[model samples]
Target chain A: MGKMELVDSDGAKLSSALNRIARDIDAVFDVLLPVPDDTRAPLVEAMRYSAMDGGKRVRPLLVVATAEMLGVSRDPALRVGCAVEAIHVYSLIHDDLPCMDDDELRRGKATLHKAYDEATAVLAGDSLHALAFEILTDDETTPDPFTQAELVRTLAAASGMAGMAGGQMMDMAAESADYDLHTITRLQQLKTGALLAASVEMGAILAKIPREGRSHLRAYARDIGLAFQIADDLLDAEGDEEKAGKALRKDDEQGKQTFVTLMGVEGARNQARALVDHAVGHLGQYGEDAAVLRALARYIVERDR
Target chain B: MGKMELVDSDGAKLSSALNRIARDIDAVFDVLLPVPDDTRAPLVEAMRYSAMDGGKRVRPLLVVATAEMLGVSRDPALRVGCAVEAIHVYSLIHDDLPCMDDDELRRGKATLHKAYDEATAVLAGDSLHALAFEILTDDETTPDPFTQAELVRTLAAASGMAGMAGGQMMDMAAESADYDLHTITRLQQLKTGALLAASVEMGAILAKIPREGRSHLRAYARDIGLAFQIADDLLDAEGDEEKAGKALRKDDEQGKQTFVTLMGVEGARNQARALVDHAVGHLGQYGEDAAVLRALARYIVERDR
Candidate 1:
């Protein structure tokens, strides 16, 4: 009740909205996945374990907030929201595998591979990938099949070879060979930024926003996406954010080239702030409805996590 | 020219048709995942390596053959065929991962993970999975958005937790625990049968054949899917086919209770024959149009590789 009163400011409103979006999207996940007692019990368990009760739900928040701002209902937005989160969650699950990052902890708990075995984790990540497309195409997600098809295309483009997965391959390559700032930036843009931007774009797609009508929104997403990564690099460099903690903390120890390493920590933080400002400027055409997105842009730079 | 004239009977006709479908489907795959010499070159290379120059292309054959039988054009059918083959290739890539079956050989060549590293293999498989969904929803696959959505949904359902991936989870669990005939049947049904059925069902979907119209066709798929596995088990039992190899051979070595092990070799062979007969019986409703499917069922039982 007290938190509800604090939601009047743009900053607090975005926070409250994010929390609400997380819960709503999570409900959608629960309904789709349920509790696995079937032959896929371990897989269902693994999927539920990775997707539920986890993370900041930033991708879902962007989808819901953007769609709601564009006059789309929470239901369809949440469906796409959950779908994008599935892609994000799966990347995390796979990225944490032993052959990859070998992470033990994620979102303050053991990573899925640690919680389950490597095989279950891999399969769960994969099933989640399939489930994302499944939800986008399901009737509940969109009564219009055309809209559903677009959602599938958008999610796939963001997750595929030229997007998230390709970015990951580059990331692994960087582990063996030193990368310059341009290469690292390009890598993170594909790795982290593409999916984030896709979440907003999917929201726009659900509302049938045309390509010409989406330039400003696309710009806003691009700015915020990069800003989010820069802030993340700063946090990982700091290595003191109690909650922003996980596998990335060891990147510096591993001599990996991150944004903070390429640009000094202060410079990286400033770049994030500057990008956040640009991100907010890109939303100037929208009215009061754009307040949540504006606050989210600022939050990208300001949040500890 | 002589080969074309030789396609008079069911066996020769189906064999020639299968070869044609494989070539057409491979061409489609070449277009979608074109060879890359860029930064994502290795990932693209890995993808092309596994998906191209490959196995029997049975799934794509089913799609094309069924679609042609129904008088559907070749382009869309081939697109769907390529999508289905993407699923099959991705499954093989992941199955050969060190954490899973860890097979070093596939199609009598070194597996993707063996040729490249394990991480590239994982990303390549993941990207291929995304590409499958991408192709299903692509405009070239079908101009009708509703049809595209149906394709996406069908592929997802056949590949996700309740489908192929879930079946794989059960398979992994079976390694540590004993499963009876019913459990193994259900497992393989989900694992192998679901996708095979989906390939046929996708053809029907492309031709706008409603669910009720597809009953006998589905029955044929079920019978042949089971028979295919039984024949595979029999092959493994005999340990004679050098190329029809990998995972099942290890299962036999480990004393896994396959169909041949449980039913006895002669009994399993009889069951496979009965299943092929039943599969052909299910095709009686169609005229000469169902000849390829009927021949394919028999081929499932009798093929050496």
Candidate 2:
């Protein structure tokens, strides 16, 4: 479990791992958010609707893969993965709200606000947000109080004003204001890169890796985060809507400048591939133990959705 | 500072303490939410606008007063207070959204969504929610990692589906459902009571008070929490908008069931007074040192706004 034994650095293994982690995460959410037999039932139901099954569970996979590579036990790794996934799911729910992206479709279904009302959607996102910290701070997540505190701090900072939400604010602004390449890069780093990087950093923290020891992991995460966003831009630009499971060409529709818009599809694709290779290179020190992580990096660019 | 040796538990002294704590909470927000010179500036600005210089700062006062009663230091108490207040303010921002209460005025000024756009308001609320956990888990909040983890667990539980948010969901249902007094009481307990109780509980946690030792304080908080809500219902039924600093009588307009509606104005007023008295009674063991907490309980029923 510590080294992902028997798993090869191939697309098949990565796909299986992704599927496994997705199911694991959904199970965790089921335990975390039971609908009460009371007036609050709808709120918990909405939370479950959005959080239980959806998305690639990429953040959770990142956490578990990184932790397992670093010799952490599977139980703790999976719990940490669930915590990160909860935050990711909550963000998606909020992002799809009418006042925000106003997206009707997500994860191949109507968004939370469409399935429930806007109020329930808002509360559901909030409850899931709280649930993430709840899971991280619970004694069962990890016995070490220090690790719990660190996890809470890391996730909160990444999700707040200077991280995902801030990045989203910048994205909202991009529709009206002209953003240069640097500003857009910064925005993407905050919006998506922050949480992605945090997912890896949290695994390192759980493994008791010192701050200095995390530099390579941080670098690996940074490269893949950028690559992931680039690939997302490419997907939004040209990937099939059915395969992607959501709307595409949104940046174009909104007239927002994206990596694809700024660098052209060919330029963006080349950049993303280069980043994937560079990211995989960072894991060379770990040899075979980092194989899964290496494959994850490649999968970022190769995945159709 | 722990004993409040020089101050008596008079109304004037309580008034001064409230004002002092209000300023202290504002100062903390000023430092915690500085607007960066970037695209995220508007988001931070909106957070600052909503989180600072408003409300009674009652939650923080509860934290500080309770912690001080148990001999916790002022600095840490203030930090914890700020953390709880952050959650409270964030909830207010979301509660006032168009999809929720659709409030135009709050604390005598335009609500966050009215002052800024709906999207900014949502992000600002979300950022502050993250900020609360960020503050709670910071080493500066407490030297003890255990205390940090405990604080996070307490706040998250009180803020999530089973606490404030859950209570809010019940309130939403009251608009259409025929809520009896029992259901309304249960709703208020989750909505406002949980956070209020947590404020006291957090102070006890900071002081390392054993769980058994916190029963009296918990009782005190429960009584005050209900009294606070009853007082709110009373104000909504008959209080002035200018004095209350928000639109009142919305409960009557919406035809929602509330304490006042369920128990009649006189019955509700008497119940609040009785609860305040009972709340103060729970502090008898603390003697003169519990003066501030007792005053707070009394103030819950007596405050006009």
Candidate 3:
């Protein structure tokens, strides 16, 4: 269920797929990112730092995986994958800015604006967010005008106030010492889970899946999103800063209300386990083809970092 | 044909429309803007300052005018109109920050980041950008999904690096002491013209106009956009800072290339007139239906502020 087990079994294929996608992503990033020639240095550096800092590409991979599950070729999903990563990168870029988390560490290095200047980081984030939609709407691979519209709406909704921004608002609100559990979970769901849900839901929609399946996928994403946040809190509780590539337990100083804050550490772990089980149950519809997804849910909870 | 004549004739109607739409737009803004309570005060205030500024909703007016031209109801375009305004306000908020323009005034009031702090302004801009699309995708008026998708792509392209950001980049790059007319024109197109173009073109799309008509509208918008920028530059050249609510002759001091910098004031006036004439010419196919657009173009070049 852990990264070790998944790595041992499907390590080569996933690695090769990830490597290929990363190259494609980097190439596409080169073209799609708007680095005006004169001011390109800071933007290029910021974009590379945020985008290439290296995550599992889980969202983009979900795009490909979801497409695969729907019996569609992965090519069309490539742009969606790129778009999803762009959103993720943009969120990370803004989240790390001095106005927000004011963090120095992200992906094992200085957060954007810290590595670059504040203005450059801000522009980079803004440009990247715009670029994500631009990538989604490219006339080349995007389905029809209608589907493109849906994609736009879906991603926008997820990234905006009702989704990530809403969560961020809640998170900011919950910064006080007495935030309740419901309020904290609400923040995490909207802030972190919304885009993750959109990442999967976007892939499903692109594959033209039926409504029933789409709903199921949304449910699965919701469960895992909460589970992922809980896992994040758990990691912060015990994770090494070097391995986690960011300051650990920093949320405590910030008085951030997290799952572990709301529920005791053991209770938070139990909740995460329950969410994972719920997510896996939803995957029952996909059968053995859901193996990657199954492994992903496990990885979400069990990863040390 | 120009401002004084149109103002004398349709002043009542325009004022009433403006008043009604303004109220409607205000209500929408109040309802849709971030309400982050005490915890999220920073994000909320930032969004409000950027979005709720009491500016004339010219872009939203365009949406209404174009929709009326096509004999469609304005209800569907209402939310989209607000969405466009959100993007516009967000862009201005971000653009007026110290790193961008260091401006203190917009619509005769302090700019968002200036009124609040830089961080809130940044977050407000970011969230508002996302909010624009969120409004488009929400099932408010139930525009066809295809139409919504096209709107998404259109707005994204208009707002991204190739549009607003690209223009901002050119503006930033033009901080040097020398530049030519063409570069100046290009910069103006990206900076001021791009969103203006989106304003008109997006209105056209929302009305579900034919492709040929859409192209013509874009051409008309392109001309008007240039005219708008030229007129603004001319105003700055001769404008009173108190009336303009922004500095005058600053472009000259910055050594930035502008139409006024390239051509003498008289020449810029001639260019603005020509562009407006060209904008009017493109509406020949629309006949009497384009009267409001023609009026708008005239107003752009002739308004005192």
Candidate 4:
């Protein structure tokens, strides 16, 4: 096949995979969160609303794609995908609160706090946080208790203070502090990179690939994580707000130092491209089986959203 | 010993145990949440401030006492106790948010949101929620992966939508809804009772007691769980704010239906006493070795705060 044809084919495959996983995740969340006929119904409804039919499902797609490439079955992979998505959704719900990012729109709809009251939004986010662990430890997710425990540890470490929340703290400080490129990189690594890396790590974990064997995959995830953030910054700087589906340019508005601010737009774009190239190189060992992942890495930079 | 002497001795033992576990949990949290010399420092400080030196350490005490009674070592029990306490602390932080109960005082000090900013408070609670699972799944907590997974499942179930958060949702609705006694009972069961029951259940889990063997312990937990909430309601109705160290009678002010509202003060007191007696009776299978558990049940009703 010609190079252009190869790019087109890979792009088609990635798009199809993304669409499929998004639907799968929505189905899983539907089954996971059922509204009860009681006072708690609104809470469950809010949780379902914020969790389903939202986002690019990038985290879940990464998990499922990487797990499948490693010869793992799709059932466990989808369940684990849902677990990571739950964490992602919960964080977004909390982040969009009036006290945090205060964004009114998410995934082309009202944020959780706007859709429901703040109290219900907080409880719903918390419930989803708990649901992540619940799904991981459930026997139906994986009968192997060791795998279950390992999954929980991976996710908890990535989501907790030293990881996503810690990164967020740095981001919050970015509004006031004079952050250099090094600080911004570290901030992004924790806030966004950690969970992205965890998605790949969890895939290897489900395959029982052994920690030492996952260096290449970790490098791939790290590169793509950075590239993804840069692209996000670029989108916030120049991409269409309607396509992004949330308020863009808020980073600039907040005077928060980001990749685009630290590095010029051209410099940041080149850096993201370099990272994507490096990320794809790490997957050369997996050959064609890694096509979707490589495509995902490219998609991280290429997509408007 | 005479009945009076036995009662006095048990009370003394329970008090000492409570004090000791409180210190132990604080020390564990101190180690677990050291303030890093970075932007995340404030987040860690907020977490440490709320998690340590507060709240009677009742959950941790229950985990340790019950585990020790079942012949488990103290080290693992303390770790598990810390895990449960982390969940309890996180819930309290979230419940005290301005959008929630809006309480300024917790554990005789300012609530987390009052101490830190609202965003930091939200992140700290989320971090602590993640930390609970992290502690449970750590190899140091339990060498057995099965046990670790089980612990995560128990804590997650108790703290999530079907548990404490679900109950909190009901509690929030109580301000506007006309709830009957049955609804209130169910609400309390999910809110306060779930974690309380999980504390005892976790001890049984750590001891590797089979599900069938845990029947009496489950019954004991169920009884004590209800007794604990009823006692709390009574405290809210008439207990001294100085003694409680927080605002009291807010339930009456909110016009919410509580155990005190559904059952009058004398009726609630009798119900709590009956629950304590029933909880203690269920521990007969453990004989004198269950003395601490029995004391804890009585203390649930007897505690002023």
- For model 4, the superposed segments whose C-alpha errors exceed 4 Å read none
Pick by lDDT: 1 or 4, better one:
4
Backbone clashes in model 2, listed as residue pairs: none
Ranking of all predicted structures according to DockQ, beginning with the best and ending with the worst: 4, 2, 1, 3
- Evaluation by TM-score, superior candidate among 3 and 4: 4
TM-score (C-alpha, index-matched) for candidate 2: 0.96
Mind giving the per-residue lDDT tens digits that candidate 1 earns over A1-305?
75344335788788788788778877888898876665578789889999998888889988988898899998989988989999999999999999888888888899998898998888999999999998899888888998898888888999999889988888877767688988888888888899999999999999999878988988999889899988888877775545765755677777788888889988998899899889888887776788898888888787776
lDDT by candidate, in order shown: 0.86, 0.90, 0.78, 0.92
- Candidate closer to the true structure by DockQ (higher is better), 1 or 4: 4
Which scores greater on TM-score, model 2 or model 3? 2
Q: What is the lDDT of residue A198 in candidate 3?
A: 88
Question: What lDDT is reached at residue B226 by model 1?
Answer: 90
Regions more than 4 Å wrong, model 1: A1-8, B1-8, B245-248
lDDT string for model 4 (A1-305, tens) is 68778778889999899999989999989999889989899999999999898899999999999999999999889999999999999999999999999989999999999989999999999999999999999999889999999999999999999899999998999989989999899999999999999999999999998889999999999999999999999999999989999999999889988899989899999999999999999999998899899999999998998
RMSD of each: 3.3, 3.2, 3.2, 1.0
TM-score of chain A of each: 0.95, 0.96, 0.90, 0.98
* Model 1 Cα lDDT, one tens digit per residue, B97-122: 98988898887688999999898888
lDDT tens per residue, model 2, B150-186: 9999999999998999999999998899899999999
Candidate 3's TM-score: 0.91
Clashing pairs in 1: none
